[model samples]
Target: MLRIPTLCALLTLTPLASALELKPLALYQSGYPEGTEIVSVQVSSMRVIVSNSAQGQVDILQLDPAKGLNRIARHSLVAEGMGEITSAIFHPSDDLFAVCIRNSDGLKNGRVEFRAAADGKLLNTVEIGIWPDSLAFSPKGDFVVVANEGEGYVRDGEGFRSDEGSISLIDLRAGVAAAKHSLITLPDLAGVEGATQAEHKRLVERMIDGEELKIPFGTSPEHIEPEYVTFSPDGTRAYVSLQENNAIAVVDVLQGKLDKVFGLGTVRHAADILDDGQYAPTAELFALREPDALAVSADGRYLISADEGDTDPKIAKTKAGLPSGGGRTVSVFDAVSGQLLGDTGSQLDDMAAQAGVYPDARSPNKGSEPEGVVSFDAFGKRLAVATLERADALALIDLDQPAQLKVVQVVGAGEGAGSGKLAPEGLAHVEHNGRHFLVTGLEKSGNVALFELLK
Candidate 1:
């Protein structure tokens, strides 16, 4: 028989400690369109804002967390227009946000639209280069940088034809479109070798429409290759993920030049070597290998990168690409110094492999990729990741122990145990009216899931 006093103390401690553990309070189905791919989430005083790109429209949904997942407002874009909305972000202070809309029709150039956060009213539109995939604001919030996917086309009877890719810099303060930077052009072996009258006509048309342009950096820039971009907390440094090149380029924003280029998989530099070895010890340059998304912690202590693994078939593929493997993980880094801080989410792949589970081979689950990472409550103690594939689960990471960041909770779409479909794409935490919320976008389902974080 246990003593009453001892048992009471144990009960009190157990319940109190359990209550302190971080967990999802509720999960609501967004009821968005089937093809709707939810891209990003931002929380504000008036509403819980979500961005979705599907059916050739950018749909914004406002939520009442207290009332549950009901849409307070909605916005749509026409199919024939610049309909593919790839990324959206809110301004730090104002109720204004920007969306990068990709031109899927191929007739017009890509566009960046600034809208009022309250009702989704379009305020201004800026025409960017082809297939703009991602956008990021400088630390000072004075300018917007875009990663234009650059020319989308296919083969013709004579030979292969593609559009020119480029990046655009838009000055918000100037209230005008800035200069456009063209992607470096590479010598086309097939086009040059198989030159024909039709091929020449296609090239001339491309030249007329700003195709086959030079990047000024290098040759043969792949289509829409610059997939994602992120800025340091101070906005002094900018990092762009060159997906096709398997590299991340560090750019000096003030100088407007590439400072260093580091490969994702190889060790390129000595850790302690620098201009002055006595001070400013240089970090060892290590490769990230298939980096997809970038996130900086709220405190600006760490930089987090999501590695989606590799997809190229001709290259050396890991077991992750195999039918029995799910292959997804997140890499952490020291934000100030750019030092690799190890990786997390290996358990997902290990569990899948051990269970003989594999993602659909043909679909090549882009949704399965770990697309975004965010710190919970802005304390940098807890981290959340959206696993687009593996059934769209949100992983809660414990960052207290810097050496061993572990997943504490895995939240799915429905109330019941793993009852709903979640293809979470992007994540954002916002505070309004003194309350905080966690928001995520689903790519495959085109819905955004909002949850009230338990303190």
Candidate 2:
């Protein structure tokens, strides 16, 4: 069973003449057992769906921005030979959602399941290979594209290695996985020079586990390494973030081929730069780091990529790498032109250093690392972002005036007040009747916080 909490205080939000009025809708926490982690959230007109990776279940909660929060329904999925739920999203116009679950034992085989949004009823399931990270639906809602994280373990001459990663194209209309593409191939690394044979071998070995793992023929020249996938408003173009390669790959949707790759900047060794210059090297890591969470504006004019700092031991083992610094930061880009549009929110180091919470430069919780960005308002004026490491806060970015962005108004999840103590993970705008509200999933506390957006 799921639990819903009542809001003790409801503040009437006044709208700014140009901005929309925002208010606190009800907030509800998931009913999973203690220690269960809520990984992501998706909101539909009638319900808000929360998924727990640790519990291996997806809970459906009734949302009433005007009345308060309520858990109308809940359901647990059969393990389906996968480990946990990594990502999920509701179908644009239906009560169905798609989720990607990776294998628990760290094998390459994963699964994608389609379920009824209202009751959490299992509708269909498909087995996939490797760790699938993100899922995006095609414009017509006919296809779903998955970004596989690939294999994690490698054999150093003793045991069986795990190298599984690739992207699978599932035909929703046909209810089957139509095509699978390996992202570790060289073509995926086009325009990337200095990629050595050892790196290629490492990438290949990291994608599939055994000697039987061979590159597929007729695979498009596009390199894999895809982390998060998003589509344009009209679904005409698909933008994929290639975290390992430090670039975003734009794909020609209809043709299903890589059109271009946008690199963030130069990479360098960590020890060479001074403290003042340390941020430069760190900033390079942001550009080159794995882009984890991705969002497209409602109008499809902009694409935002949230880079989760270096978590890989292998990458961190490099002398140039510093312990993943400051919380995370976001990069906004022109979806069409592929141009960079500055960053949103503060970096982990800046947040930690500013808060005086951690005196050491190598402190772990590195204050305020921003993680995910979901969507902009219907007018394309405001953006809602999630800060995973930075307590509970949703960053609102003003698009009409780019210079005015990053001026955030922290709401709900009272980090200072002590009412709530969870980091915000996923965010989305939910509309009831004609009013707009912001919904955020608190990963640490296993709950969802609702806030009204003021104009």
Candidate 3:
């Protein structure tokens, strides 16, 4: 049995509407089209990059946290009909940036384009795989990772989907001026020691659509989709979130080998999820945690994941908009040991519910839907900020005690109704003018909301 250690800080469940406050200081609006959305937001020294999916452009906005946004520049990653931008990130030094653009040629090809951070001029482009959802920079500024989520195609007759997800490592030992690009596919990561290959095969060992297969869901080791990647503090290793596969891949960057892939087994004891399709006020809990966005601790000791679950395109949507398999939780892991140290189970969902920011309509499968995550050291605490998409809220977690994680605060409607964000996605922590703050990208509303982290 997986023992869930109690949160020593949360000796008693504090009623939600009361906790640390997350005052929304500002919201910057961009006139991108309705279909086009701000899916990802990455911050630099004094600028912000927002990836416009439908518009195929990456906008570099001059950011003044106290003020709003100034559109300093923008660049279209693809031709009018060529492709679209998936995600973007700036180099550690803030001199250059990169964007992963997926070609429109049947989701067949993708590329990582390097550009000048200030002028947004194209420097170079390197070929990668299909459907790159997210990317990241190494802390040492020597490499970048592109998570190519190869979402398969389907025909009317074909019963299952393709599993061609992968990750591309762009080595900049010689700098972006001259770089080497390499791929680390799901198949490559499968056999590593810490990986869950054997157990995953056993659990998924069944037939699908009358066809006898190694795994039932067309999701085997090779199909393990790479959704997001975060680097360790020292830049010697990285962790990739396989959202659908329910696994995390640890790569040794310096050695360029698979260090290990920690299999995050299903959440079996979650006690706060909404467990019915009625979208009722009543609530219960179940298990099944599939994480999306992930981050590493400053000391490189742990990894934090936002367990926002997902399903296939072939799967029908419910009235509540949830996947059949999902655990409304936040999980923490021992990076090197690949041991699941602890998780914030349905506590996040319970927090959202009490805050009244919980999206009842998105119950059962995705209660809070913690998506974007970022970590930093704040006031002597190893802290993390999680963006709850369905709940339209931001949560601050006290990670000082990794084994006994606590919900230090919840920012949502209960505290300040209209001040809350809607469908928040990406999260970034920043320090400027000797003050701490958080910046997030709001997808549904196309707004960038900023909050001052009051100590």
Candidate 4:
């Protein structure tokens, strides 16, 4: 078990409404550099795989009921020129796992490597689109989808340039050896079946407005970066987060095409738009729900998003001289229609403040930056676990009543870095041997903290 000197910070917080509690079990140190980030994590049976992005490697660990988590193997560079590991996910039924790796030069396309979960041995290597940032497997374990972000960069002289942001659909029906990779390029907004002309116009007006883009990049089809991906229950559809554009792309996995692109419009709510020491909801601003992580309900009826806010700072200066088009809450939307259902208005930020874990420094920006989210069934209740990157805490929201959503618990991870920031990036929920666990990767602290769900 790891020492939690900071857990007492939440003792004075309000009581949780539900019986669910995250009991801290132990912390597994990555044994890497001090600033090395443990961003992505996934568990299968007794095995766990974590991504060490700064070091460009994936560390495999084994969970023992008698002991704790122990490092089993470390793997890196399935092929030369591969960059940092972006994300990793284990197969539902097989002893296999997939990882998204970007190009070292950041100019070429990336690849997804399938490896064995037992020993982290490379099984298959399939090249995908540029900058594959996130990965997801179909429910039935027949297919794996990669969200190729295709991030843009600026040179010394030339302006910003980017690769076409696309999605990669890998067919693993025959197995990883026979994987068939296909890239689904995002069509223009006008060509998308589910995209509305009015939504497109509003987005352009908010970001461009027929003038030179105040931001660094344009919100064109090629520049629409895919951040995270979640699949439908039946494995027929996939939802991809278009973070910078403040939209979501629905991909038809079977047909292997970009079906639709619908924008997640702005959310006007009470928030703290200043970095002052006072934590007050003094401003009512219209924030663009630039969702970073997404999760679809098991019934495929509701799509939930953790809006971390990726709006450009330059654009915020133009918007009433305040940080308006930013994300700081989780939102719920109708899965099929892409209609807004309900969102936690200022609840997340408020809860963090009350719990004494809110990052007051981030108030002027996206406070509490809820970056990673995962929905799972545990303790006879449907719950969504959202990681607050800036606050170094986890918000557990009850999803049984989607419309009447309640934040049941807000638990702090542990002691943060020397700068008082843990920066929890990726989250994974696993049920093994009759017990459920929430494994979180703390990026700045270089540790994977395990929490056992208990009544």
Q: Give lDDT per model, in order.
A: 0.51, 0.54, 0.67, 0.75
Using TM-score, rank the candidates from best to worst. Answer: 4, 3, 2, 1
Pairs of residues at least 3 apart in sequence or in different chains that clash in candidate 3: 288-327
Candidate 4, residue 217: how far the Cα is off, in Å: 3.4
What global local distance difference test value does model 4 have? 0.75
Best by lDDT: 4
lDDT of 3 by residue, 1-455 (tens): 11122454233454333234566777666675222223333434567777777677777776686575666777766777787777887777757888888776533868999999777788888898887878888986789887888754432254445547888888988978697888886664444433333333222222344454433343454467788889999888888887777778787888877676666765644343343422232334433456889999888888998888764221123223322455666778887877787877556765665555656545544666788888887666688889888777888887777777777666762223323335778777777776677777776666667787776
Per-residue alpha-carbon lDDT of model 4 for 1-455, expressed as tens digits?
11112445434334445677787787888876433343333444567777777776777777765567788878764444447788887788788788888887555889898988776788999999998889898988899999898874434344445678889999988988999999898865544332222233222222122344433435566567899999998999999998877789999988988888888877777887776675677687566778889998767888999999765552345346333445688888899989887787777877777666878777777788898888877777777888898888888888777766777777788765212457777887777777877778888788887777888
How high a TM-score does candidate 4 get? 0.87
Error of 3 at 184 (Å): 1.5
Candidate 1: RMSD to truth: 12.4
Choose the strongest candidate by TM-score.
Answer: 4
- Which digits, one per residue and each the tens of the lDDT, describe model 2 over residues 1-455? 11111222111111123444334556675764322223333434556666777676777666675566577666677465547787777676677777888877664577788888777777878776577777777756776777776645544475434443455666566543343332322254544532111122222223335443333211123224567777787776777766655556676665556576665532222211122312222333322344556778777877776655433332333334332222245666678776666664443333223222212222222223456667766444656455444434555445554433453443434343112256666666666566666666777677777776665
lDDT string for model 1 (46-148, tens) is 4444555655455445556566555655666445544777777766557667888887655357888888766778788888777778888775666677777
Candidate 1 accuracy as TM-score: 0.69
Model 3 lDDT, full chain set? 0.67
lDDT of 2 at 433: 65
Lowest-sum lDDT 10-residue window in model 2: 1-10
